[model samples]
Target: MSVTLVLIDACAASPKESRVQGAVQAVPKTAVHRVVVQVNSDDPVIMKHAITNSLNLLKAYGDRNEAAAVEIVAYGAGVNMFREDTSPVKDLLRFLHATHPDVVFSACGNTIAIMERNEGHPLSLVDGARSVPFGVVRLVELQEAGWSYLRP
Candidate 1:
């Protein structure tokens, strides 16, 4: 399997700075706090940390998830996070999805595709887990759009 990678340069301009460079590059701040969390490990403990971190952020905003947009992007071995048959935290996933529309759970489509091909069958994501083209690219896009990045 090809390793997923995200190269974030410290010297690179932020979204705010990019806006000053050109209006077309500007991404408007839609929420007070925008966060994107990355999950690339298959470890259940790591996945739980990501969920807890997201809950903490939302709780800080009085459990008003809309006050802080949060997204969880999973890829690599972490794709198992959304695997319907193998997920260890499906209960929490269901609760969070039912209660928080602002917390988006994204599975990497590329990883899913590779897994399906290798297994010679299709896969099913747990309820409320959606697909993105690529986890690394999703994280990069969110950062570019001024979303705070977190990995747990």
Candidate 2:
């Protein structure tokens, strides 16, 4: 199976990112094996969009006859999605965490620190997420490991 990675560098002004990710999930193409959504914005709205988009994508993947493994990696302001307390989109985040095993959510540690300082509390992640050192490096590593990159 081929792996398709969706790199979500933009949090604002892009429904295409979510739509493409959903499309890919619906098909479950052997041409695609893995899909990664990299979020690189700091805006709360952007983070919300990323999480919402990711959940939609995962739902599509689950409904497909075949599906690619999906990972949602958050960095910069996008890291706010993980913070346990400030998550306004808690229901959606929790739903994603509960339903999909192939769906992995990652929060960048460096971004977490910044978020905590700004938000005046410790950063939090959904129960199923892993904390990575850096988002860009993770993307590079995923790409070098043969994942196709799509900036949607």
Best by lDDT: 1
Question: Backbone collision count in every prediction?
Answer: 0, 9
* C-alpha RMSD for every candidate: 10.6, 11.6
Q: Residue by residue across 1-152, what tens digits does model 1's lDDT show?
A: 22222221111112332221123322223457878899999998888888778767766655443356678899999999999988977876776676665467889999999999999999999987878888898889889877899998
Residue pairs in clash, model 2: 2-32, 2-33, 3-33, 3-34, 42-77, 82-124, 82-125, 83-124, 84-124
lDDT of 2 by residue, 1-152 (tens): 22233332211111112222123222223424556777776565665666666655545654553345556777776666676766655666666655554466778877777766876977557787767778777777667756655443
Model 1: weakest 10-residue lDDT segment is 4-13
Per-residue lDDT, model 1, residue 46, is 87
What are the Cα lDDT values of the candidates? 0.74, 0.58
